[model samples]
Target: MRISVVIPAHNEEAYLPRALGAVAAQTLKPLEVIVVDNASTDRTREVAEAHGARVVLCARKGVAFARQAGLLAARGEWVAMTDADSLPTERWLERLTARAGGAVALYGPLRFYGVSPFEATLSEQGYRAFLNLMALLGRPNLAGANMMLLKEAALWVGGFPEVEAREDVLLGWRLRRLGPVRYVPEALVLTSARRLQGGWGPFLLRQVRNLLGDPRGYFGEGGERER
Candidate 1:
């Protein structure tokens, strides 16, 4: 199946290169890569174009809006979502396609890169474990950093929600209503640990709030400006 990879970037000049590099090195190449520049003051657009990614400008500035823009621009049957700061494993796409079968949506784990080993283990690894456990509990634990969904399914679900927080999980839940949403353990992506800059306590607390279906609790007035 042809895949279109979408990356939403906002002032991501520092991390976009590594992300695009990973996509270039994918064992299973995507048909297209769309980088949504969400009102970035930095050179996010230039970086994306340099990496041969189609750059789409989202003047409104929000991950949700950027994601929807890329989804609309995509030509592939399957749309893959990843942040500009995320580095997909070489076999990421290959594994997802292999495990997809007739599934409508597929998500995998995200491990943090370019961070202290201790922090990575505690934050990234721990979070991944939590995601797996949440899945076992029948919770929607999908992440935009490493997930794919049928284009038709996404369109039917009205694309991603306009909200900033937990839009990924919301989309997953909506997609599940149409068909099965599977988790492929082997399909992995390495994302930036910048979000955890505050502290473990705060980050985990925010995660717990989201787990309880309260994205608004931590990220107030959700938008591209927040994170």
Candidate 2:
């Protein structure tokens, strides 16, 4: 199956190289790598082009919009999404493709990188605790930092929401209704912990609220509610 790796970037010149390199080095190379530049004022586009990634200019600013733009342009049957600051293992795509055959969507765990000692400890502990809470509540909205979906399934669901945040969760909820949404534990992606550390309290508070179904705080007005 052809797989397209879509990365939504905004002023990520510093991290784009590493992320792209990881993609290039994947054991299961994607059919194409599409980097959607979200009106970046930096050299994000140049860096992506330098690494031979097909760069798409997204006039919009939000991650959701950029992701949609990339997905719409992707030429692969399967689309895998990752952040510009995240790094996937060499076998990440291989594992994802293997587990995605019977499911409309597949998501993996995200490990934090470049975190301070205290923040790392808190992140590790808190992330697991939150997962436990989600399981207990029978909620399985996975993070978008490491996810893959069949293009047909995404199209059938009318693509991702046009919100600023929490679009991944919203999309996951919609996909779950169509068929099984599997969580592949073997495919792990490492994401930077900058946002979590820079605004720990508020970031977590908003996450808790989203988990409780208050998605408006993350998506602003006119956003769809979680199913």
Please, what are the lDDT tens digits per residue for candidate 1 over residues 68-106? 888898999999999988999999999999988889999
When summed lDDT is taken over every stretch of 10 residues in candidate 1, the lowest stretch is 218-227
- Candidate 2, residues 61-132, lDDT tens digits: the string is 888889889989999999999999999988999998888768988887777889767766677567756755
Residue ranges of candidate 1 with Cα displaced over 4 Å: 215-227
**CA lDDT of every candidate:** 0.84, 0.83
- Scored by lDDT, model 1 comes in at 0.84
Clash pairs (backbone) in predicted model 2: none
All candidates' TM-scores?
0.91, 0.89
Off by over 4 Å in 2: 117-125, 132-138, 215-227
Q: In angstroms, what RMSD does candidate 2 have relative to the true structure?
A: 2.3
